[model samples]
Target chain A: MMRIVKDIMARRELLVMLVIRNLKIRYKDSSLGFLWTLLGPILMILIYAVFLRILRIEVALPVLVTGIFVWQYLAMCLGDSPNAIIGSTNLVKKAAFPRLMLPLSIVLANFINFLFSMVVVVVYVRVAGEPFGQLALLPVALITQVALCLGVSLILSSLNVFFRDVQHVIGLLSMAWFFVTPVIYDASLINKVSANPDTQFWLNFLFHLNPMTGLLALYRSALIGLPAPALYLVIPSVVISGLVCLAGVTVFMKFQGRFADEL
Target chain B: MNSDIAIQVEGVGKRFRLRHAGTRTLKSVALDMLRPGKRTVRDLWALKDISFSVARGKTLGLIGANGAGKSTLLALLAGTMEATEGRIGMCGTISSLLELGAGFHPDLTGRENVFLAGAIMGLTRNQMKKRFDAIVDFADIGQFIDQPVKHYSSGMYVRLGFAVAVEVDPDILLVDEVLAVGDAVFQRKCLKRMAEFRHQNKTMLIISHDLNTIQSVSDEILFLDHGRILGHGTPESVIGQYESFSRGVTTSDLRREWGTREVVLTGAEFFDDGGRETSKFKWGEALNVRLHYEATKPVGPSVFGFALSDENGRVVNGNNTQIEKVEIPGLQGTGSIVLRLPSLNLASGTYLFSFSAHSADHQVNYHRLDHAFAIGVDAGKRFEGVCYLPCEWRLDREGAKP
Candidate 1:
């Protein structure tokens, strides 16, 4: 890990160039550029709100918008990063450097986009009558989310090099994981559906088993003035995220020598 | 390997598992992992026991057919890939032009890509800032430096790629057929710049089919065949060995037979006046090509031509019996035809000669030999050009001579 950090420091210019390229290619031929970033979260929140209204659920509007924005950033990184190494096969085949940067760059680039979307989140938070007193903890939550995404992205991107089907699997998994993560609903609502013992067990287990549960709870605590997440969610999330990161980096470095040949 | 060698490879080899084509699946990988004995992993060794070293400031020419591990060796030197076995050590910074425009983003302008490529080659942003103008000037793609690289022609792309690579001032440069991409004028300019790089005593490893470039620029050459070094020595001697290896190759199917003529070239050999069979010729040496043909019909105005082609596929010399009107009368039986030249003056390295026989009407080509044999010219004495001409020089009396 230290060696990789050294490589990143030495190759900082290339990383910066890649970041700029990602930005340019994203907005190159578009009109009303960068509005799309805010539009994505807004549209998702609006759709979810309409569904919740039809269902007559009494969820807080501020919590709904916050969940949607934070969740969308995770979804974007999860979907895009699975193919990060495959997408940058150009650099992999021709040059030698730390391979983890390919996915890390994707995470960082989207993190920047997520930061941009925060303006919309701030506006919606104010309009929805959420207090601004919790704003100081937002950076901490954001860092945790970044770390989580980095770990998962590294794993998926490296796996995609070996099994390209991991890309599609991650794509589908991101969509399914979104619904399970309480993005547009509260965990309390699952209590109503917990009639069967199996259903109750899964609902209770999922709320803690999901790493994003802790990350989202942290965000709500920082931005929406929610209670701190349970110790079970926080401890497991950190442990799993750290293990995923270690496993991802180890596998990536082990198989990296074959990337040029395979590509 | 010598102590002064900047790069050394001792029995370096690389074996790649040739994955079944388009067979990337989680199940297959899982099965292979779980049950290793039942799996059949086809592997290809791209390099095998290739031991060589490049003395500091010396250029090594790596030549071979495709898939002979030339690029694999270059990648090893650049640290792009690790050798599966053995050891490779480089004492200083090494950069590779394995594929021009490799890391450039199509959406980036030429100027931006120059910085990107330079950075990938290990130059700092400020160092690139210092040489930006020189790179732009060297690329010579006027007014298009600000345009996206996707808009540039292939030539301009290569120019920009080469320009940035050169400006990095790499301690060792591995060039893989980069000189073959541009136009003739640009090729000359690139070669000139490469010569300047050589003059600066920078170590270089060049892989090229352009044998002339290899001969002129390389101090030593390694001939690779089927992933192993067949021979290695000074360019002149190794090229001779390669030529002779090509000379003794003969196949029955290669012997051509035409319609009722039944004209089959039974045997072909090149020799000098002494009748000694040889493929190596000194500059200005007497040369002869002997062909044995069996004819089943009487044919008139038959033309037998032999042309010499250099490594670039350019025909340097050729002559036909019809062109010289040295035709023999119609013969109904087997006979021999030999073309003799008083002097053969060609540059050192391999020259391919092909022979063909046809009718005067040019409708029928009875027999043709494609690249029948390669001839080697030793860098002995030379006046100029392909053929050396005798000349006399007179000097005014000097105090030392007196």
Candidate 2:
């Protein structure tokens, strides 16, 4: 693990260059260019807002907007990460570098896109008259989410080189995960639905099992000044994210040696 | 490991598993799990116990036929792939041009790709900046450097790739057939740069099927056949073995005779001036190819022909009695046609002799032998190029009269 870190640090410039190249290629021919980043999350927010309004859910639009954008960032990373190693087979076959860099760069590039779309989050926050004090914790929540995304990206990219069905599976998995996370709906509503003590205990336990549940709640707390989730939920989310990150690196390094041959 | 060694491979090998059905997707893997008997997996050894070493400044050329593990070995040396067994130790930075523009991004401009390629090759940003102009100048694709590389022609792409590879100034360079891409002038320029690198004492591992290129640039040649080292020695000896091996393969492939039996070619032999049958001759020596044929039936005026091909199976020279307008009378018995030359005029290399007997009008081929006889030519003195032209060069000083 130390060696992998050293190798990555040694090739940090290459990692940055790959990320920049990804961003450049992403925006190269498109006329809307960087605006497309914000457009995706905004569209999802608008669609969800209409559906929720039709259903007459009382959740605030700013909270949905923030959740949708963060989820969009994760979705994009997961969607593209599977092809990262396979797509760069040319480099993988010709040059020797830390293969971790390929998926890491994908995650980082999507993070950059997420950062660009954060402007929409700020606007929504202002329009909804949310307090600014909780916004100070936004970076912490964002970092945790990035770590989670990076971990998942690393695992999926390496696996996809050998099993291409991982890419398709991720597509289906992301949709199911989006609904499970508090993206289109608020978590407090679920809390209200499980009003009985016995049902509430199981519902909360099941919700907290999803790392993104606490992450989404944390994002809401930071962006819209919603009440923070309980210590049990928040701490487990952070711990799970860190553990996934470690496992991602471990699994990636383990399987990366076979990438060139499989690709 | 010796400090003087640039690369050392000790019993290195690579094994690959071949699945009958590609398990490259989750669906196939699941199917494979459910249908256990349907899965077929075979093992292929791409390289087996390959061991060799190169000193710090020497160039080792790997020559082999296709699927001979040359690329696999180069990839291992480049550290792009790990050996399934054994060890490879190396000293100094290694830069490889396994394929032209292997890592180039089509959407990025040539200038951007230069930096990207350089970074992948372990060059720092400042180092690339310092050499960026030199790389572009070497590639010589002016103004195209700013355009997206996708717009660049194949030649331009290869030139840029070669330029970046050489400019990295790696202590050890691994090249695998990328030089085979560009035009002749660019190839010469690359060779010149390689020579300059040699002068700077850089170690090089080159894989090429072009015998001339390998002979000219490599200090030593390693010959591979079927993933095993067939021979390794100085270029002359190893290349000699490779030539013979290739000739053996071609001859064995062409061993079957196919032609109408009006006349059967009984024998073909090479002779020196002394009339002694031999398969070896010296450059510029008197050489003769005697073809013996027996007419099975009454035949019209016939022509006996012979062709001489170099080691690469390229016909360097050949002629027939009909083309020479030497008519022969109708024959019903055995006869021989001896094609003699005062001087072979060919360079020192193996040549394959093929003979054919046919009617004067070339309507019917009585019997034809393809690559039937192989001959070796040894140059008496050091010579260059394909064939000796037998000319003299006179130098006159500026103040002196010719």
Candidate 3:
């Protein structure tokens, strides 16, 4: 691990160049260019808000909008990470660098997009007259989210090498995860599901297993000034992130031999 | 091994398992994991037990027929893939031109792709900045350098690719048939640069079927066949072995062809006057081309000619049976005809003999082997070009125009 970090440090110029390439290629020929990054979340939030209004949930619009915007950024990064290695097979096979840097670059690149979307959240907070005290907690939540994302991205990109279908499966899984993570609805609605015993247990179990639960809790606390979620959810998210990251790196190294062959 | 040996390979091998097409999907992967069924696995060994060491300042040529595992071995040496069971020790910075434009982006401008390719080759941005002008200059695509590569001609593409690969001054360079795309002039320039690298004590491994170029550039040659090193020695020795292996090859050697004349050549073989089937022939040795031609009808002036060409398709000898004999005698038969050669004075190479049985009026070709048989010319005495000519030379330097 230290060797890889040191290698990346020495090749930091290439890393930055790769990141710049990723950024440029993303918006190279498009007329709208970087605006699409912000436009994507804004459009999604508007569409979801209209849907929620139709359902007559009567929930706070600001909270729902903030949740969707933040969740979209994480979702895009997670979805793209799985295909990062496969997409950059040209670079991976030809270039000699720390192989781990490909996914790390994706993580960093997506984090930039995540930072861009944060502007929308801040706007919502000011309009809703929420105190900025919760904003202090946003950074911790964002860090945890980044960690969780980095870990998951590493696993998916590595696994995609062996089982190419992992990219497609990741796409489907992220969409499914978005619905279950309380991105549009609050988890306190656990009471609504508690009306049914089976629904309540699954709901409770999902809150603990889903890393997005931590991010949603953090976003809620920051935007609506709600208290940070139960310590139980927080602890597991950290442990899961750490373990998945370890598993990702180990699996990636083991299969790194096969990447050039398969690619 | 020399003290400055820059590349070493010991028993390096690569194994690949061919999976069924149905198992390509993720659902199939999951189902196969659960069932654990016995699946038919075909193992392809791309390189096996290959061992060689290249000293600095020397270029080793890798030459072989198609599917001879040449590219796979190059990839293994380039650190693109690991040896399955053995080790490869590489010293100093190594860069490879495995495929022309392998690192290029179609959407980016040629200038942008140059930097991207340089970075991919492990060059810092500043290093690339310093060398960028030299690369663009070497590529020689003036205004097109700023345009996307998609707009450039094929020659421009290969020139740019070759330029970036050699510009970094890598200690060890691995080139794989990438120069075959450029024009002859640029190819000469590339060869000049490679020669300079050789003079500067850099090691190079090049894979090419162009024996002439390989012979001129490489000091040593490693001839590979079926994933193993068949022969490895000086360029003359290895190229000699490769030429023999390629000559008098069977019908399976039909790589690709042109000119459809319905001439399904069943077999082609060469032999000496004593009637012994062989491919190896000494210079100016007695040789005979026995071609088994099957004709549907008796066509007039059905010319059966054989032209021995160099690897680049330049003719050395082109003569027809009609020319040798006054009458080819009309053929309505499904039998065989033998065309004999009195002397084979062609230089050593894998020469292609393309036969064409055309009308005397140059109207229709009854039987045509566009590029059928390949013969090997053993080393002896000959000029270094397509054909060998008997000419007398006198010392006229004192009386020359100069």
Candidate 4:
């Protein structure tokens, strides 16, 4: 792992260049261009707010909007990472580099989009007289999310070379994983759904098990001035994301030797 | 591990497990993990036990037929894939033009792709920036550098690709059949650039079927056959073996033909004096060439010709209806043309024959087949030079004897 990091560091310029390329290609031939990055989450938040409203669950718009922006990063990374290696077959087969860059570039590109969306959320909340939450906690949440995302992206991109069906599996898994995370709902609602105390404990435990859980809390705490529930879960999220990241790098390097052949 | 060696390989081999189509999917992989069943996977050793060391500042050329593992070996050296067995130790940085523009994204502008390609080759942004103008200038696609590569012509694309590859300027370069693209002028330019690389003391390993290019540029040649090294030595010696190896098996596999479909040469055969079809002949043996053709269009004043050229592509003898005053007024439907040789006077060497039918004015070729047939002449070193002239040596004792 240290060696891989060193290799990436050595090729950091290429990584940055590829990230720019990812963003450039994403906007190519599209008239809307950068607006789409901001528009996508804004639209998703509105739609989800409408759905939650129809379900008669009252939630703050800032909370739901912030969640959507964060979820978009995860969703975008998942969508693109599976095809990252296969899509850059030309680079993977022709040029020699730390191929870990392929997925890293994708995650970085989406992270940039996520960052763009968050700036708008932060400004609108500030302008609308909504208090800024614990902004210091944002970096911790951001780092945790980036690590988790980097891990998942690495694993998916590497595995996709062996099993092409991995692309579709990522799609289904993202949708299923999205509902369990409080991307649209608040974590406090865990009590309303389950009358049984034992069931509520397990439900809360299940939510925290998602590495996104603690990271999402930080985002909410920092963006909307809401107290982060189960904020201590950040420790487990850190550990799990760390393990997932380690596993991801392991799986990636284990199969990366075969990527040229399999691709 | 000699410091003088730029590239070294020892017992290097790549084995591919040829998996069936059904085994590629997730369901099959899951089933495979569950059952651990014995699957019928064939092992294809693309390269095996290959060992060669190229000295610094030297050029090594690879010659082989298709599927001879030349590309696989180059890919291994380029660090595209690992060798399943043995080791390849490369000194200094390496660059490979395995396929020109291999990583070029069409949606990106040529300038962007140039930088991207440079990055892929391990060049930093500032390094690529310093060399960017040189690359674009070498590519010579004026003003197209700002435009996406998809909008560029194929030649422009190749030029940009070749330009970036060489400009990255690694210590060791691996070129694989990339010089064959672009126009003749650009090819000559590329060869000159490669020669300059040699003068700059950059070691190179080039793979090209064009023996002339390889012969002129390579300091040494490595001949491969079916994943194994058959010969490795000076260009003269290894190319000689490769030529004979190819001549012995010049069955339609080596045929190079291109013509309009108005008329086509469907088949060709070589026959000895006894009417036995054979590719081998004595230096003075009578030989006959028969060409079967199918003409889809009616032709007038058609001239059929065949030229016998030596391995160096020098024509020792050529004949045709126009030259022989036997012009056909028309050629319609299927027919055969025979060029009967009373004596094959070429010296002992491998010769290739090309057949063509064209207008009497040599304006248009109804059909032309080029170097489609290879015939070997056996003279037992009886004579020197290309042609076996009808002359005898006389030992007359008229002389200044010391």
Q: Pick the candidate with the highest DockQ.
A: 2
**lDDT preference between candidates 1 and 2, better one:** 2
With candidate 4 superimposed using the best TM-score fit, by how many Å does residue B392's alpha carbon deviate from the native? Answer: 23
Ranking by TM-score: 2, 1, 4, 3
Candidate 3: C-alpha lDDT: 0.78
* Model 4 lDDT per residue over B59-148, tens place: 999999999999989989999888999999999999889999988888999989998889889898899999999998999998999999
Q: Which stretches of candidate 2 lie over 4 Å from their true place?
A: B21-23, B27-39, B257-373, B376-402
- Model 4: what TM-score for its first chain? 0.95
TM-score of chain B of each: 0.69, 0.72, 0.68, 0.66
Give the clashing residue pairs of candidate 4, or none: none
What is every candidate's C-alpha DockQ against the true complex, given to 2 decimals? Answer: 0.61, 0.72, 0.49, 0.61
Better model by TM-score: candidate 1 vs candidate 2: 2
Please, what are the lDDT tens digits per residue for candidate 1 over residues B227-326?
8999899998886565566443332223233433446566678898899998888767888878888776777767777787765557788878888988
How many residue pairs clash in model 3? Answer: 0
lDDT of 2 by residue, A108-219 (tens): 9999999878877887678878874467667878888888999999999988888777877887899899888888777877778856988987788678778898888888
Predicted structure with the largest TM-score when compared to the true one: 2
Please give, for residues B168-273, the per-residue lDDT of candidate 3 as tens digits.
8899999998767787899889999999999998999999989989999999999998898999999988887777676645322653443334333455778988
Instruction: Give the runs in model 3 whose Cα sits over 4 Å from its true position.
Output: A195-206, B27-37, B248-279, B282-284, B287-342, B345-375, B378-402
Give each model a TM-score.
0.80, 0.84, 0.80, 0.80
Model 4, runs deviating above 4 Å: A195-199, B30-40, B251-342, B345-402
Instruction: Report residue A67 deviation for candidate 3 (angstroms).
Output: 1.0
User: A52-96, model 4: which lDDT tens digit per residue?
Assistant: 899998888888878888898899989889889999888878878
